[model samples]
Target chain A: MSRPLVLVVDDDILLVAMARSHLSAAGYSVADAQLGAEALDRLDERTPDAILLDIDLPDACGIDLLQRFKRRPELESVPVLMLTGKDDRESIVRAFEAGAIDYIRKPYIHYEMLARVGSQLRIGALMHELSERNGAMTRELDVAARVQRSFLPRVAEVAGATVAQRYRPTTALGGDMCGHFIAADGRLALFVLDIAGHGSGAAIVAVAASGVLQRAINERGLDAATLRGELSAFVDIERTGFYATLVVCMLDTRSGELQLLNWGHPPPLLLERGRTRWLSASGSPLGVGIGPACELQTLALGEGDRLLLYSDGVCDVARDGFELRAQALELALRDEPTPAAVAEAALAAAASETIEDDDMSLLVLQREAV
Target chain B: MATQVIGIEQGRLDTSSGDTLERRVADALAAGASEVAVSCGTLALVDSSGLGSLVRSLKRCRAQGVSFKLLDVTKPLLRLLEMTRLASAFEMEHSSRSGAKTSV
Candidate 1:
């Protein structure tokens, strides 16, 4: 509890003194600067809770000073109440245009001055408190994003294929998650999960699910069906109400035979030699207890083939329909045959003036077609 | 002024409408509607928020011991639900069997 501080910037000695005495008597700590340069120096030393700026200063135009003050990102929101002489309509209008939040005409009435100062102080305090809270929240989310990132595997060679992934969340933390597990028997198990909701809860679940499967898949090769079933059994939808559209596949790189199961996700696309094939949605998403009866399907991902797994965010790109999206995807793959290139092509179509519509994630596995 | 309740007509669900959609279904249940069915025939799109509303609606119905289901779900809406594996979350009267269409 110290009193709110006010910085008074004016060239008039008597007027500045009056303001300082009145504001101090009204429970405010006051500081005054006669020149605009002095006022700016005071500001650089430390930002006060509020500023009362005179519309005219001997050294510089207060309007110019106000513009400069507003330009600083840190002080953009601080309340600046312009002090204008009565009948100076142009100065009052110009002060506001330069970012003064409010103004009081001079021949400064003690009561009016105190009232304007008090109200501005309240708003300034509230804004400061809000920004502090937002800063703390952002820091916490950054840590959560880091933790979620750590659960994902490092980009490396799985069996004989080069594996790489790219994911972007709409927010600080997102629900879309992907992970790769290389089993003891050299089967590379890869999964891409998109949770139903966005933000912290979905992100937490995505990371947790990734961790669970990584441990389980690395222990003993869990077939695709059992992997989905075990994941479903592991969750209590009634309690957490969290479910994810995921596709998990085990690739035996040597033979290029991939055992795949997709629960409700966009099918993983398979690009081999000169042809392209879209993977179908073979089952239901996890956590709904839908008894999603899906049999494991085996597809050949021979040498020189690339398989791409992506979230539904990519599906939202095509304007006409799914057929258009498929055609675009196939062309991109045939042209470059790299996971990043095709994923980029899909995203460019989805790109709006705002730069994004939803979170997009891509995991690419390419078998060296020796 | 009479309160307006949104029925299952032609509203394509999105994040912006999720809360109102939740309240509308809750009100219908509160007013002693035995069974609530929403028609999704004209819905061209359903985003994550729209799906979120359906999940909440299902929860509210179970809590109030009333029945609620979706009707005439469009192919796009059904495809969205299927991809999310939410096809079994509701019982469809005109089950377009809208799901089960896979790629590749």
Candidate 2:
């Protein structure tokens, strides 16, 4: 194992030199900093396992420096030994109160100083271990977040319709999911699901739902209602007790026919000719008993028509007893030609508010007027 | 803060409330309350964290054969639940009877 690194901070070169010799002989990697400023700079370069801080410095007091070190969460765990000449009970108490792990008096015995430093090094090793473990856990969540992103399609485009999406999870991994799929029959399938909760539990349910949707739409050629029923049954409320609100749709450009199925989700928007209309969900959300068969409503889409699908995280927040209504949602859709531009414009409107409590995802589909 | 009795006269139940609300719900389930009624009628707003806590609480209640209900949900609170598609997840004391869109 490599020797633990120790930083010795003192204005007196003689004392610094003495610490260097004692620390080096004790099998420690020593770095001497003659000024408080220099010591802080060394910390920035690499965190030492323990610090030997002088009580008196040209630029700052060692107690003040100790406060600064404690303020930094990353440096808080590192043991700091106060090097003082006063040896007074008042100063010693103050040093401990200021967060000094131990103290060494001026003109101290070499062996005594070595013992204090060694004790600190052992505690420092445990501190470093805890920090590393926390860091590893955070990295695992990051990796899982990226893996979740992979399950959703990046983009789906075809000759008649173009789909664009933007997804944001409240936590590193969230319950919100969205995807667009172009079927072999020239029908485009798009969906956005919001699980009741967030974090790993919600994320697991989202992944399973999205995975099934991808497979059913791509291979089975199922309709929106049938797909909804199957997915609802798949999530066992009696067992997992996890449910989701979702909007799933399939658009066929060949006959300008559109099929939509919604369960306790925000209504999708249809914008054309500077006008916007809401698409109806009108059914209880899934995992709530998969009640009466879902009704699939058919609508027509021609050139210049744009459809918007989103999760409720966009309008769940109420202002003055009113949340984003159809009129407000209509304004968000405005009129953008391409799916990318439309989603961009709409998301900008949603981002205007500061407080958001839910994860958000948006998917826009536009039929090429040309 | 005590967790056994979670009765808020009027306030916002949010992350700032910490795990207090969650603990109360857990205690209710542990005590075998046939149905735990969370009174949101006095609550002005609840953020996503609050909603998430409720979801977890409901799951716990279900595992123990208990019902989780939102008591006297206000118009704004009901709208929020509906928008999130959670209107059907938890039972509501006052339903379409009060012209409030909620699960019976």
Candidate 3:
């Protein structure tokens, strides 16, 4: 291992030499700087593990310089040991407040200097290790977040109809997921689900659930009851005690027919001529005992008609009240905006409300003019 | 058999609270209460984790053959429960209802 580097800043040449000899003998690399400017220049060249800064310097006040060093992002964590006169009690206190880790009085004993330096070096090393470990954990979380994003569907167009979707998680990973695929019979199958919690555990369940639903939809093509059954079997609901609200839709593109099954999620909106109508749910959330028969509701979509699906997070917060938030959303859609514009406006409105943060996902589909 | 009324004071029951509600219910059962009623009069929000805790507690009550119910359910919570089809699964009384029995 490389010897821990120590930067010693003092106006006294003899004291600098003495500290250097003792620290070098005790397995430390010593760098000397007489002025605060010299010390900053040395920092620019290389970062030291610990700094031995004198309270009195030629060019700058040592405490002020210490504060400057602490302000720098790269040198903030480096241990700073202040060198003070034995009677300078106020400077000692000021040095500490200015971010000095430890201090040694002037006319110091060689052994005492060595001991303080050694102890601080060990602490600095431990802090460095902890910082590195946290960095590694954050990198791993970012990778998991990327993997989660990969599963999100990029359904810009489905069967000649325009589609736009957005997902915003309260954390690096969230439980909200949406996907779409066109069937051989010209029907577009799309889905949006929100697992009960947020974070890695919920995200893991979300990924598993997404895979299961994706497979079932591709194979069977929009069987709400069978899809629910498959999810009940696949998810270890008993072990995890987790559940999710989902909406599955199959739209016959040629005939403008839309089939929707909402399971315990927020009601989807049917937007027509700048007005909004809620398509409310009748079924229970999944993994909650499969209690009731989930009913599939069929509707007819006219030209220029749009469907908006969103997670509960978008609508949970209240304005004057929760009901007002829905009305605010309706007012935003009054201009008959595109899917993306509608999403942007809804998110802006949601941002203005104060409430607990949850994963928000919005998917909008609009039929083209005939 | 005595009824134990446990009130939820917090506005939200979510991942941050972990399994506090479940633990409270477990404590009620351990204390030999034959019935448990959570007074959600102050509760305004519940996420998936909170819902999970409720379900787990309900299942625990069922396993021990104890009666469990939620009292003073808020409109927002009721909407969530109804949408999730949990309203039927849980025996709940609306907040406006009167004359329900309570024991300390």
Tell me the alpha-carbon RMSD of every candidate. Answer: 5.6, 6.6, 3.2
What candidate 1 gets wrong by more than 4 Å, as runs, is A1-5, A33-48, A57-61, A71-78, A233-236, A317-322, A352-357, B1-11, B30-34, B55-72, B82-104
Worst 10 residues of 1 chain A by lDDT: A349-358
Better of 1 and 2 by lDDT: 1
The residue-by-residue lDDT of candidate 2 on A260-304, one tens digit each, is 878767788898666788775666667655334456788888877
TM-score of each: 0.84, 0.73, 0.90
Off-target runs (Cα >4 Å) in candidate 2 are A5-48, A57-80, A87-123, A154-156, A219-225, A232-234, A290-293, A317-328, A355-357, B1-36, B46-69, B84-104
lDDT of 3 by residue, B30-77 (tens): 987898887877677777777777777788898899988998887767
lDDT of 1 at A189: 80
- List, residue by residue over B19-98, the lDDT tens digit for candidate 1: 66777776777666666666566677677657767777777776777776776778777777766556776866653433
Candidates sorted on TM-score, descending: 3, 1, 2
lDDT of each: 0.74, 0.73, 0.80
Instruction: Give the Cα-based TM-score of candidate 1 against the true structure.
Output: 0.84
Compose the digit string of candidate 3's lDDT tens values, residues A180-294.
6675455787788888878898898898888888778778877787888888853434666678889989888778889998887888888776567988787877887645767
Top-lDDT candidate index: 3
Indicate the DockQ of the complex predicted as candidate 2: 0.24
What does candidate 1's lDDT look like per residue over A315-365, in tens digits? Answer: 642122755666766776667756667667766654532335567787778
TM-score of chain B of each: 0.77, 0.76, 0.85
Instruction: Give the winner by TM-score.
Output: 3
> Which ten residues in a row are the worst by lDDT in model 2 chain A?
A317-326
